[model samples]
Target: MQRILLIDDDEQLGGPLASYFQRYELALTQAVKPSAGLALLREEHFDAAILDVMLPEMDGFELCRSIRKDNDIPIIMLTARGEVMDRVVGLELGADDYLPKPFEPRELVARLQSMLRRRSNSQVQDTQNELRFEGLSIDPARRSVTRQGEAVELTGTEFELLHMLASDSGRVFSRDDILNHLRGHEADLYSRAVDIVVSRLRKKLEPLDCIKTLRNAGYSLALRRLP
Candidate 1:
């Protein structure tokens, strides 16, 4: 059974959610306080975490930052506000995804499944083995991209974009689709931010010509070279 740690102050919602997830074959654990959640996290191993933004002792963002310091564990933030800034801040804070409150329980389940699926798929691909396309290479496990044998440093967003494009080479993904893939349940205000990340990625992959941008359409990776 997949272990999921849920941290939320709303006891009412948290109770039902725990029951709902338990029915779906997930071992659900709930922490009503941030401190308790942190304690559980340190003592136990969980596949993923569902965190609420507003907490009594300490905010979720602080908890998230603390978690990110040592754990790359996937995190899904729950926010009641649904503000764009809040979502962006969560993303920038290393949250894997965010879902606004007053949301369907089914939607939360779906998002959790998506996060797990992505992590599982990434692991199954042998990303630690390294991928080479012509002179370009990417090691997903190390989170490193290289061109012509030289290493290239990438931001988290840039690495994610590259991973998405590379995972399904030759598939045309729209900006909205890319944003959804990255943000999951989080609301994105600037869809054009996808283009910005792609541009930065393109610069890093300079002279490789692997990622091809389609004006007004989206992006597709060159499929013939890499393996």
Candidate 2:
């Protein structure tokens, strides 16, 4: 069973949700406070995390930021507001995905499964070669990146975006194309989602300047192959 952590103040939400998740072979652990959630994360292992935007001690964004400092765990934020800015902020803060409140249990489960599937697929590829560029390196099998011979820390989404562009360097990928590849679904909400990830990836790969953004076309890897 895949263990998942849920950090929401609604004590009532956890029990029923936990039972529902068991039907899909997922174990849900709940923490009503950010402190507790942070503690659980430090002490135990979870496949992913579900954080509520409205929480005690710190909001979901802060919690996401806190978690990113130490772990690259995939995070899905639950927000009642569902504003575009909220999604953008969460994505910028290193969340892998987000869902609005009052969502169907099935949909949440589907999102979780999709993320885990992508993660699993990346790990068991037939080809495990490192994609090397002028000053950057991407190891698909390890899901790791190196810039200028120094290891670069990337969230799951950021790494996937970088790898996607690196796989076909110089090929323009539309935002919709990138979205579908990352989320395994049609792009619906935030069009800037791809832009945010690209921006973050760009910052992380600083000094290399490998990712190039076309005026309106999309983004592509601009680095020359190191052979």
Candidate 3:
């Protein structure tokens, strides 16, 4: 059984959801407050987490940040606010996925399964070629990246995104294409998560601006390094 942690104040919302998740072979542990949730996370090993955006005192964004500081577990944020910016902000803060309030239970299950699949697929090794684009180099075996011979620190997701793009420099990957590639088929086809992640990646890969955004189409990596 896959262990899932749900950090939401509303038992009304979490109760039935937890029951429903069990039907899909997911075991859920609910934490009604941020402190308890963070504590439980630190003490236990959960395959994934569902964090509510509207929590008491320290909101979900801060909670998400705290979780990322030490752990790389995939997170799905729940927000009542249907704003695009809210979704973008959550993604920027390192959430793997987000679902708006009043969502169907089936959709939530599909997303959770997809995220778990993505996480699992990322760990599988089919090939481990060291990709080099001039001064920028990626060693898949070490899962490390270096530019100009200096080590670059990247989040797991960020490194995966960069490695995917760098692997095929000429291919223009649309947002859906990249999301599906990273998060599997059940990924949201129109979320701004890709753009936010890409923006963050650009900042990290700075002084080596190779990721190029094409208006209306998508993004690509410019292999021609700057001198």
Candidate 4:
């Protein structure tokens, strides 16, 4: 049975949702506060989490950050705001998905199933470990990128940016889109920061020239060239 941690202050909603998920054989644990949620997360191994945007003591964003710092487990955020900024912020914080309030229990179940399916599929196909294009390769498991068989050092943020672009070769992503996809929030004052990371990644990938910059658009990986 897949284990899921649900953090929300809505006692009425949380109780029913737990029962609903139980019918599907998903072992569900509920916490009404961020600290309790965080504590549960640290003490147990959960396949995924559903967190509410508003919580006592600490908000969902901060909880998401705390969870992300230690695990790559998929997260789905619940928000009543339903704003683009909220969605972006949730995604930027490494959430796999977000659903606004007043959602149907059935829809939430579908989303949870979808996320679980994707997670399973990703794990099954993750045997390659290394993705090679030209002389550059990325080891997703280790979060490492290499060029010309030489190990290249990258910050977590930079690696994530490169991984996002390279994983979807030839797809054009605008700065705003990339920011949301990578940072999961609005392209704020630090939106241009993507450019800086791209520049640094380009410098490291000089030998391969696999990263292409689209003026006024965003970044894309050149069509994969097998080394």
Best by TM-score: 2
Judged by whole-model lDDT over C-alpha atoms, candidate 2 comes out at 0.90
Error at 176, model 2, angstroms: 0.8
Top candidate, metric lDDT = 2
Could you estimate the TM-score for every candidate? 0.69, 0.97, 0.85, 0.68
Which residue runs does candidate 1 get wrong by more than 4 Å? 126-128, 132-137, 141-160, 166-173, 180-227
Residue 91, model 3: lDDT of: 86
lDDT of 1 by residue, 1-227 (tens): 89999998878876778889977778788899988998999999999999889888989899888887666678888876647677667766767677888788888888778777766766566546766677877788877788788978665556677888877778999888897876564544456456566776787788878888788888998846554
lDDT of 2 by residue, 111-213 (tens): 9998988888888987589999999999999888889999999999998899889888999999889988888773364568888899899898898788888
Best-to-worst ranking by TM-score: 2, 3, 1, 4
Among all windows of 10 consecutive residues in model 3, the one with the lowest summed lDDT is 118-127
lDDT of 4 by residue, 25-94 (tens): 8878889888888898889999889999988888899988888776767788887754667766776666
Off by over 4 Å in 3: 139-153, 224-227
Cα lDDT listed for each candidate: 0.77, 0.90, 0.83, 0.74
**Candidate 3 residues 43-149, lDDT tens each?**
99999999999899689999999998877788889887567676778889888788998789898888889878765665666657778887798877777889889
**Quick one: ranking by lDDT, best first?**
2, 3, 1, 4
Runs of candidate 4 exceeding 4 Å displacement: 126-129, 133-136, 140-219, 223-226
